[model samples]
Target chain A: MSEPILSIRHMVKRFGGLVAVNDVSLDINPGEVVALLGDNGAGKSTLIKCVSGVHLPDEGEIRFEGRPVSFPKPIDARSAGIETIYQDLALANNLDVPANIFLGREAKNRYLGGLVKTLNDKWMLGQAEQSLAALDIRFPSLTQPIESLSGGQRQAVAIARAIYWKARLMIMDEPTNNLGVPEQQKVLELIRRLRDQGVPVILITHTMPDVFAVADRIIVMHRGRKVTEKRTGETNASELVQYMVGALDDTRTSA
Target chain B: MTDSKAMAGFDEPALSAGKRAILLISRLWAWVFLALMIVFFVVAVGVFSSATFLSVRNSQNILVAIVPVLLLGLGQTFVIIAAGIDLSVGWVMSLASVLSAHAIRAAFNAGVPLFLSVVLGFVAGVGGAALVGLVNGLIIAKLKVPAFIVTLGTSFIVRGMSLLFSENTTVIGLPEGIRDYGNESLFYWVRGEGGGFYILDKPEVSGELLRSMDRILAWPVVITAVVVLVCLFLLKRTQFGRHTYAIGGNMQAALRTGIPVDRHIIKLYMLSASTAGVAGVLSTLRFTAGSAVIGDPLLLSSIAAVIIGGVSLFGGAGSIIGTVIGALIIAVLTTGLVMLNVPAFWQFIVVGAVVIIAVLIDQSRDLILGRRGRGT
Candidate 1:
């Protein structure tokens, strides 16, 4: 097999007296969907937060594209081609669709040889329309603010933003949560599309059906430790539940 | 199955004609209200009083009155849209006024050229206010202190500094040229002695000239217009304006998207203070003196204009044009009240009522539109 795209070695994170993520390691390869499953307080979010630069790891090295990397902030991680779709969507809800698509990285028209620059609204709007069209998403009006859009449309905008910036690795934290049944299906389709386009996705979710549907490999965490890792075909829902509940453990000495 | 059926038709429907009309009206409500107020005053003053409220002279008076309030509102527009407030703006203006007066006087007394002294005054005034803005920005942005507390504290500090600097007295003795520049009209159309028309430029302001001055647009009015146009362009066409809305709309989203949030906040405060500085210099020029108390009462009026203009106090959604109409509304209301021989205190009560009315209209607009149909 080809080399892994992202490799975490003995990752450790602490919140004062609590070891939120304890000495866990994992590898993700290109063009694959990896579902990170965990119960409440299982440190799933904490681990991803470290890679996305929301939190710095106390101990561990993150290698992206075969080079050791450290992200001082979310922007640094994004600049290095890591885009994270946070649970809250990380969108400026008061802004219009095109504006959100190019929020921090706005396109500009320069005058006086770049001394004066204005937002290239027309260009951004056209590009946003094309990208959404590429994703087979439709909006009644692109000029309306994000708050006016449906939850599914907002999710589509976020995914389009990552794609527009050419993100190498997409991290989605519960993208289908709080969405309607159809919206959930739409988001899953987008994830499969991302995988098809050779952009690896790390999907953190609690939905067992979602894991089986889209994830090629499932990694379960229990009590801040990796309890088991299995291919989609090798694991059943009931067996995976045992690992999630700590009834089974591959890393345990007795087991 | 029902959910899937509904999902297939989930695309938002187009706004109906009636809904579109409501959206347009709500968006332009400030301008509509300003027009209505003007017409009401014109009719009331004509019916109940001997004076006309719609004359060119009265209109000029209203425009002149709008200068300071509009300037203050202009800066406040940016701050409010960025989900911040700078209470220090009023005293910042006073401080700028005092500093400029001192700078101009000192330069003139030292035999500096009159023109250069005036320029120095401009520098000192705007620069001083900008420094206060810098301090305000640093404390609020870096320390993560609430804007209300920081600006309120700075307002007191600035007010005290102004009084201390001016020695609790007005700074006077500016060169006569400054006042002349302030009063000069861009075009003066005087009725000629023989009933012909004579248009003069930079005509001297005298009792005789004033008597025959059929029409006049003063330099201050023109200057204010230029400033307004520039601000409108800055807030609409530039990247800075877009980022201001983003920061206010969702600061966390802005940070995650890689915006330099703190630096932008500092720049916003500075922009606000510098506009206050501009108002100060204009005030000093108009009166040929600077008092630490000039901007004391204007702060609330400026904020009132912004709110009345329909810029949401919640931030991220407002316009320069709205604030302009808001200022006009207040000025017209005050001028009309005075014309009707209302008590001086009535102006405050009336303005407060108008502010409440404006907010209520905004809220009603939102309710009427509902969540799915709100406009930008």
Candidate 2:
């Protein structure tokens, strides 16, 4: 790891009297693949929302590249090279692949009234194709609407889009949950490829096999606390579950 | 515009999990706009000039004659796009016009620069509307009041502001340059018997039986052209335009994607109202009167044009082209009805019918298209 991409200290989030995320500290270095595993109502979504700038933390400090940062809007997060692929992916089904890839950012010619007044489809389509190809996606065509792609193909396209836009940190919330078995495998391969390409990824999932398969490090959340942080090779599934259920804290002696 | 990745299969779990944005240009509304154009032209020509009604000059005159309303229509596009409405836009126009005339008179007499005063008056009109729009946006976005209630209230407030200035009196003095914009043509003027001076403008077509309409060219037509072209650029080419559509389409999804939804809506309201103010200035310049009362009839007319232009009341699916065409239709219908000596009250009846019919057409098309397949 060349540098720490994300560093959080004493991060806390509250919804009225409800403590959704308690004082928790975590860090992810460049090119690292960290998995955040938790059961339902374990504050996974709330924590994700805080990180993705959907909700502000009540008390906390978030640092990107050692500089203090707070995002009031998701655009601030995205512009700073942090891209979150939401559970629903947030892809506009009505937009074509190239259009979707360039959503909110259509390339334009600087010179005004240049008779060829249109979106830079040539550049966008080329990039979309290259991204899908780099991620080994088997989508039908760049011209097809994203809705036409299978679930896994869509996930691949999403990962490809994030990586294409030069995201140093990709936050994927259950990229494989709705995907077919083969699609899950495709996403697994995409995750490993992202890490190998020096793009750090934050994989939030409850799937034990997924955690064991690609995560270099694991952070288990139980009732809004980071109960465990261990290397994938340093722990087994049962110990991770105990940490997730809040029965234990950071002790990987079982593995 | 920002949420490109919220894509899910129509039946996928992702679809059920979070709301998504639909980015299609809305084919149903486009078709409805086309139908309105056909109906408007047919009715106007049939009811008025049997032979010269659908001629090129007549159509062009119709297009040019309605340029002021078309400008006002541009403002309506923004307000409606932001899911807000401005009933005060008409009064804003009248106020802007009277102020411009009063400024011109003051500048012409005091040895001060009339150019600066004209600019100042222009700014006053836009600034006044913007002030009201900001309040409208603040009340709607911050206070959680419905857009209708806030704007409806502010409309009266703005109208009262204009009344305070006008005092039931039309401003008397207007500079030559301003009036030239409304009355003069570079190549020609439609001169009548005994050297009567008039441009080939609105009052002509509805008055005399024209052997040819091409001979009657008005400056408003030129104004309409420049306005439509600029509006198209703003709506389709710029970042602000994209933001406007995104806010209208699905605001929640836009927010998750990091769009500044509130600021965007506020800017839209300002843009909409300010454009109406500009229209008022032009109308004042054209009529050569600082009449504090302008566009009283235009409140309904401005909104009708936007709706009939194919913009959905739900927002996010319209073009400047559609709006211009819609404005032309309204002006032509009015002129044609007057040509038939139809009572002005009946004109209101006709306009009301046109509005209801347009909405119904839009709704029915939505039904027909809704039953059909979904494509990007």
Candidate 3:
């Protein structure tokens, strides 16, 4: 089998005395959609944070493409092609569409790049329009501030930004959060598109229907430890619920 | 089936006509108010004949009079836009004026060229204010101190330093060149043949035009215009400007985006202080003296102008152009009242009432917009 795109080995993350992620390991390969399912404080968020470099594991190691790596900051993870779409979407409400899409990494004028470099609005605007159009995302106006956009449009912008950056692995925390039924469907479709385009996605969500709709595999974490991993087609939602509640301890099982 | 439906089409929801109108009014309300006020003064002066408020001379006077306030307000706009305030700007200006005046005087006595002395004085003034701003920024940005308390405390400390340095006396006798630059009109009006004024660059006009009509242009006003232009560019056209809005809108989001929030804030405070320093130099040049209390009244005026300019005290919105107009409104009100023989005390009451009214309007606009769409 080809090497997993991201590999974690016996990772442990603790906040003071409380172990938030205790000796958990996972591997994610290309073109795979992995859904992280658990109740609140089930170590799902903690594990995702550790992978995306928002939190460093207290023990164990993380390897990307078979090489051990450490990310001290979120930027470090981003530079390594791991984009985490945090809850709230982490967007500046005052900025326009193109500005938000190209916030930290703005396109600069090439000729004036060395001297008096300014934002290349023309290029950014064109690219932003094109990206949204390709994703079938329609917004009111690119010049309008993101603050005025509906919740679904805002989520679309965040997803488009991650995809535009060509993230090899995307970590989304509750992508369907606060979304209505239609918006939730749009997000699920976005995730499937990411997977079909050969990008691996790790989605942390509570909705069972969302997991069944798109995710190819489901990993359930209970009390800071991974209890089971199952193929979406092979296992039912009830069986997955048992693992989430710590009712089942099918440890060391490969999907 | 759901995937196909979700992926197939996205219908763009258009903004309703009423919501669009509300947004338009909210954005342009400040400018409209300014224009109406100007019209009111023009009509009042034209009918009452109390003073020549409609003439170019009165306009020049208003421009020059509000230069310092405008400058300070320009700087305060940045601080406020970044969700911070700099209460010490007025005192910082005073300190800069005293320090620069001393430097210029000392250099002139030591046989340095008048121009060099003036430059040295200006640099010293800016440096002093920059130091004060740095302390403010460091405490507010790095140590996480509230900008209000930090700047308020620094204002007192800076005022004390100004007093201590000048030994409780107003520093006088600035270099002749500096004074001339401040007082001299770039363009002046002379008496014309038809009993009106003819604008002339030189005072060498013969016959009836020789006597001064009124200054058409003043150096202080020119400096203020340049400052306004530069600030407009900084706020509207630069990456720093974008970051300022970002930080002000949501600091946590700015941090997650990897913006050096503290550094941007520090730079903002420093810029605010530097503008205050420039205002100080202009003040000294205009008055030919630097007093410890020269900036006392300016504190209230600058804050009032910024708030009145539509720059939300809550931050993340506003423009330098709005601030310029806001400063002009206050200046015009003060001058217009004086021309009408209204007592200075009553002018204060009027301005206070106007500020409260402006804030109420701003708050209501936000509320109305919130009901229409996502409330920023």
Candidate 4:
């Protein structure tokens, strides 16, 4: 790997002494899909939250582009080129596709910036159309609100938002949860597209097929600690499952 | 491109024509209903009452009378769109009116100039109401109290305050200059000697048939129009309006997305109360009196106008123009009934019935459109 985009060392997070993430370390490389595999309460979410700025780690060091960094809030993480697509999608159903995509960071009119500034709807609509088109995602209309869209379309819009914002590192938590079979396939394709475009992705999932399909490497966390890490090319699905349940003692396996 | 097209085909299934029609109709239903009501009134009033039922003077009066209701409705629209309601608007208006009235009286008694006293009175009145709005916003945003309950409780307390200050007596006989300012006509239409009408001309050519033409734009009408236009611009063109809708649509989604939800909501309540204060100032100017009970009747009617205007009680789906039409409908209904010699008691019944019918239509439209329970 030329240089890892993000590196974490000795990360620790706790909730009232629960120790959700204890002494975890990981590295994510450019164009890499890292599948964070773990059972519920295995601290997979806590570790990701720490990186995404949802929770401040009790103790740890996080580096981006080989520089130490801290994200005090979600916005800080977002401004640092990190985007998270939570399981709920965090979309306003009442707002249209373009509006939801530009909810927080809206594009303002060039001449009409600040104090009296108004939204540049035309610019935003065009950008949204282009972004969705880039991802091969089509909606009935850009003006169609998220609530009116199908499940697959909603997911596509969410992913398009992350891509349109030029996210260097994207964290997707259960992106396929509650989606139908075809919708799940679309999300999987989206992840592959991201990787092909040289963007790094952190996918948290319990589904083995998803991990084997897109992940270049798998990191299994158990009981608030990273128990094993493996290269997908070297390990089979059965062996990854054994590591996940702690049946195997190997902490690291090279392809 | 070809691969993307194939994927698009798999992702976006086309909506059937039946579904399209339902969507279109559900969206335009409010406009259609409002248009139909106006048409029905025009025809019925023309046939049953005097031809002057559609006269300009009557229309101007309706416009003037609906100003306060329209202002209240506009503010309520914002609050409701943010998934909240302002039950204290009417009482706030009343309190503001009393405050300004006292300020004006004190100034005049203290030997101040009429013009300066009027200006100072307005400032005091609006400022007092703005303070009340701040309190309301702080309590609701910080305490996390449900808006419906908080505003309801505040309504009674504010009403009592207004009564206590005014001593339950109407302050009448305001300065003639202020009264004139309120009653000033933007312009008027006078009929010619042979019966041809003149536009915005003084009533120089007097005749039995000569009367003020329809569309006599009054000062109050002008003020209402300006206020409405400003609010429309705010709601449609500004980020504040978008944030209001987002917060109303789904507060959790808004908060998670980094929107300052509490602060935005506080500002919305303040806007609602401030508008109410403006209405109070206008009321004092028009009535030339301050009474604690003046705003009582406005409370229910303004809410009714908002509902009739197609602003969903569910929030995040309404417009200022819709509320304007809704206010007009109420004013027209009341005026038409009076012209038809309908009893005051019967007018109340009719207005109440119309409000209930509007809500029923809204519900049926949602059910037929197959979008029930989809607001969030």
| TM-score of each candidate structure, all chains considered together | 0.94, 0.74, 0.94, 0.91
Counting clashing residue pairs in each candidate, in order, gives: 0, 9, 0, 1
Any idea what lDDT model 3 has? 0.84
Residue B179 in model 4: shift from native, Å? 1.9
B288-359 per-residue lDDT for model 4 (tens digits):
777677777797899999888877788777788889888888888888778777788887898788788777
Give, for candidate 2 chain B, the lowest lDDT window spanning 10 residues: B1-10
Pitting candidate 2 against candidate 4, the one with the higher lDDT is: 4
Q: How many pairs of residues in model 1 come into backbone collision?
A: 0
What pairs collide in candidate 3? Answer: none
TM of chain B vs. native, candidate 4: 0.89
**Clash pairs, model 2 backbone:** A75-B258, A89-B5, A90-B5, A90-B6, A91-B4, A91-B5, A91-B6, A91-B7, B64-B221
* Worst 10 contiguous positions by lDDT, candidate 2 chain A: A139-148
Residue runs of model 1 more than 4 Å from their true location after superposition: A253-255, B1-10, B14-21, B191-200, B203-209, B365-376
Which tens-of-lDDT digit does each residue in B191-213 have in candidate 2? 34423334444334434433322
Candidate structures ordered by DockQ, highest first? 3, 4, 1, 2
Per-candidate DockQ versus the true complex? 0.45, 0.18, 0.50, 0.46
The lDDT of each candidate is 0.87, 0.70, 0.84, 0.81
CA shift of A24, model 1, Å: 2.0
Please state the error at residue B363 of candidate 4 in Å.
4.6
Q: What's the ranking of the predictions by lDDT, best on top?
A: 1, 3, 4, 2
Q: TM-score ranking from best to worst?
A: 3, 1, 4, 2
lDDT of 2 at B150: 78
